[model samples]
Target: MKNYSILSVTCLIFASLLLVLGCKDDTSGQQNAAGQQLAMSLPVVEIPTKTLTAYVTYPASIEGVVNSEVRAKVAGYITDVLVDEGQKVNRGETLFKLETQSLNQDAAAAAANVNAAEVEVEKLKPLVDKNIISEVQLETAKAQLQQAKSSYNSIVANIDYANIKSPVDGYVGDVRLRKGTLVSPTNQTPLTMVSDISQVYAYFSMNEKDYLNFIQNAEGATISQKIEKMPKVNLLLPNDSLFEEQGTIETINSQVDPNTGSISFRAKFDNPSRLLTNGNSGKIQVPKTFEDAVVVPKESTFERQGTTYVYKLDRENMATAASIVITQEIDNLYVVASGLKKGDRIVAKGVSQLRGATEIQPQEIPFDSIAQPIQKVFR
Candidate 1:
């Protein structure tokens, strides 16, 4: 009876051990299946062709098309500042008035001298006609009278010059001199400046390599023709906002600047509202268009060891890393130069979680939907 009881206990212990091992194996299989399901579902998109424009920006300086300096023509103290800074004025309008007290006194003396000389000439002419005095003496008196008159006229002209006037019809710049400040013609600094803001010029520069490339890509035999054929460019203000008016590239420097090794370019913009002024700083955005280019969203790309890549989806929805050469990056899209083409499917997001040849259940999405809020620069 004892031997039979020992045999029954041993069988029962073995049976319990087998049941626990079988339960563990089933749990492991279920976990593996869950992980595979999670990896299979990811968003993918088919590449599309687009007309993309990329901007190459350079630092630009703004200036009025006509910047005229206001200077005093005669030495004097300013009595009145007729125009305030930023005030709009017309041509020949008085900007400032210099004190004419000393000039008036000098003019009085010159006038007296002219009168005395005229009286003497008249007396001498009568004597010469009567032959009572030598002709040489009369001629000398007439010459002295003419010199006195010229001196009087010069003093009168100087008094008129004391009223400084605007040379151009434009807005006034800073008031470098105020009331009672002494100014002269030979002063190194100008009294003030008048800028014609009806039109403004934005000056920018490009290096030799870029200039050559720009010229070669333009469709013209001459520089002027190239400018005529080139598309209009946009201006970026210092605050990073686009200017309301578009600008046209009007002039290019004939020769490259040896010191800077860059060529200068001038673009003109209409400033009807006078928003742009002299000495304003901004950027010039020169656009280069890529027609019917294959582009991908930046989110779908990753960089590895300085090489850009995207996870391409094969026919079987398997993810494989493919290299791409980027020609230009605009806003949130990359213009693919090589290694990718239109209609190719790429993992839209979650590319980091994928591995080589990993099969996925691609949930296809529209390309534009993923590349939202793209800058519309093509016009």
Candidate 2:
């Protein structure tokens, strides 16, 4: 009986040990499976070589081809605003009318003086002819009549100046002086402005270095020839939309601005629709072409300490962060200058979630699917 009890206790102890070991083995297997599933599945693509055109943008200001300020010829209170803002007017059309009541009164008084002088000269003419008065007296009356006529003409001219007229055929700008506002030629502010919008000018600037590069790269010996050879440029509107009409490089300032250390350039665009007006602001985009350039999607790039990097993949699908130097950025692509080559495999997305030497299951994708469509690229 004692041997049977000891054998049963030994069997129970051995069974308990086996159960604990089995549970530990199962837990270990589950941990290993979970770690295997943690490796992320990311998309990748091979770099491409293509001819791409990039744009270098600079701030631009829009103005009408002809901008003329409308000023009052004589000082007077404004009585009539003949034109409204943005109203189209022809040359010599009335723009504003100043109060002319005082001028009219002066004109009437001068006319009466002329009539009196003429009557006195006529009365003296007969007396001089009859020898009733000396010839000197008649000559004196004639001189007074001439002076009165001159004064009358002067007053009449002033009354005509009270009606201000448009100097050019254009659309009117802001009316600075309203009804009852006094204005004159010497006043700093103009009554209004008129601009011809049949065509427009887009003025932009380039630094000294860029100017030098542009002239040297152009295919011409003279500045005028270079401008003719330059490609047509595009304007980006204030809302970030591209202007429908393209512009040509019309003029390059002969001298650089001493204060800004930059040179100004003027581009002209046909404004048949009158969409552009004076004081409008936009950006000028100059196209630059790169032949057989190695390009990458900007999405795959990451910056670290001022250095740009990309996750380049090897045959084993292991990603290594490699530094790259970018030459230019076009829309959604980067033109690489160095540190990367054509046909190199790179991670397409999720670069921030990756680390160096990380192994990934690379799902190959088309470059176009990863990169945004380029805008206004020629070829």
lDDT of each: 0.93, 0.93
Tens-place lDDT digits, model 1, residues 1-379: 9999999999999999999999999999999988766557889999999997889999999999999999999999999999899999999999999999999999999999999998999888878999999999988988998999999999999999999999999999999789999999999999889999999999999999999999999999988899999889899998889999989999999998989999999999999988899999999999999999999999999999999999998888789999999988888899999989999999999988987778888998999888875667985
**Tell me, what's the RMSD of every candidate?**
4.3, 5.4
Relative to the true structure, candidate 1 reaches a TM of 0.88
Error of 1 at 155 (Å): 0.7
Off by over 4 Å in 2: 1-13, 23-44, 109-150, 300-305, 309-323, 343-365, 374-379
lDDT of 1 at 252: 93
Model 2, range 216-329, lDDT digits (tens) per residue? 988898988899999999999999899999999999999999999999999999989988999999999998999999899999999999999999998888899999999888
Residue 44 miss distance in model 2 (angstroms): 5.3
Find the number of clashing residue pairs for candidate 1: 0
